[model samples]
Target: MMLLLTQQAYADDWGCQVMLCMSNPAGPMAVAECVPPMQRLYDAMSRKGFQWPTCDLAGKPDTPKPFKLDARPQVPGNLAPQTTGQ
Candidate 1:
């Protein structure tokens, strides 16, 4: 769908911008300035695929905890070496 494509494009652009901004000494301070625009982008993206929850997982009236990413290790490399011919 067009909406999904648009969302993906916007996300990619935002990610690039964030990465560029965070690659400097002033990166930490720059985050505050980026928040508003990022928030607006998120709002627009959410509107495209917004869905109301049937039940509150937190049990609170209006609190939601979204998923996040964490660093993880990659698969280990093979120890054996290959020969020229089998």
Candidate 2:
């Protein structure tokens, strides 16, 4: 069905972004754009009876496993930082 394909398309896009973001040597926190997609994936995984979405084009499904967000120290003058401070 068109609806299923549409959903799959969004999932693939989100999965690919998650893959690239998680792979960044600077870490996903350093990539501002990574948050939303990662959050979406995290939410889905957190739900009961979660199913892993197919992301063949994004590479191995086993990779980019959900990770805890690291706490970063707050810097003066910066109103906001991507990650919460310890």
Candidate 3:
């Protein structure tokens, strides 16, 4: 019998910001800003036999709730549309 394993790496825009902070821990650390999307990616990777090491946040985790991207626009009706052609 043979055991197969896979690895998947993903970094979001927010995660990138955290990585820029050289002061952070040097091991696997989860940045709350990217948790939502990262979780989804992690789940998919797990299904394929990949493993993600646990991450510890120095203080409070920055995980933000997922928001719908396709929801209705919130532009106020009072705002006048700008004309491209004058």
Candidate 4:
């Protein structure tokens, strides 16, 4: 006998200044839940030193860019794909 496992996926989301960071963690959520989690993701990525399309949420570069979401894997510290986003 064989068993198959299906993967769960979250809705694609974009957050922060510009369409900078995107996330699809776990499964889908209500529209209200998107921003906070996405903000948390940006925080995590910032802590991990992701070196592109950054934003200073506390200060300038406050212009909101048109929202866009890309299905790209989160790559941090220029490490291998197998490495966690940390």
Candidate 5:
């Protein structure tokens, strides 16, 4: 029981690290420390069929929510009629 909890905690921490490394503007490969975590992520995703991990530490939601979009365009005016040059 205790070992399970410990493993869960470790996975959470690793997930958080992976999330941060991925979000880096320079990209994951640029970070020397991110290589192993990235490889682990790839292996887990490719072989174990695991979903991308979320970071609770980074305030990530368990499931992604779709953003709401306006049904209509914001601009009210239509474009002027096109004129061809002689």
Candidate 6:
């Protein structure tokens, strides 16, 4: 039973991926960076429970250079106020 539980824990591990665009010596470039299986992060922010294939960003990723990162609150998918609808 313990072995099965351990395996289930490992299966729940999630990846942290980010895209960074920067000014390389050659030119502007974008690269994907992943800091995976952030166990401590998982512990702190798993209040709503584990969500697969997605993360609630605690802090925005850094923009390397030559690219501007827009600081704005994203519109919640279905939470937006409807302009029209009886």
State the local distance difference test value for candidate 2.
0.69
TM-score of each: 0.24, 0.46, 0.22, 0.22, 0.51, 0.16
Query: Model 2, 51: alpha-carbon shift in Å?
Result: 2.6
Candidate number that wins on TM-score, 1 or 2: 2
lDDT per residue (tens digit) for residues 1-86 in model 4: 99999854333323342233233334333345455655666676777666434444423567544446765677788765664676
Number of the top-ranking candidate, with lDDT as the measure: 5
Report the Cα lDDT for residue 47, model 3. 88
lDDT of 2 by residue, 1-86 (tens): 35543333365576677777777878775877778877787899999998765556643575666566767666689576665565
After the best TM-score superposition of candidate 5, give how far the Cα of residue 47 lies from its true spot, in angstroms. 1.9
CA lDDT of every candidate: 0.48, 0.69, 0.47, 0.49, 0.70, 0.38
Query: Poorest 10 consecutive residues of model 1 by lDDT?
Result: 50-59
- Stretches > 4 Å off in candidate 1: 1-30, 49-86
Steric overlap count per candidate: 0, 0, 0, 0, 0, 0
Sorted on lDDT, best first, the list reads: 5, 2, 4, 1, 3, 6
Better of 4 and 5 by TM-score: 5
Leading candidate by TM-score:
5
Cα displacement (Å) at residue 24, model 5: 1.3
In model 5, which regions exceed 4 Å deviation?
1-11, 60-86
Of the two candidates 3 and 6, the one with more favorable lDDT, higher being better, is 3
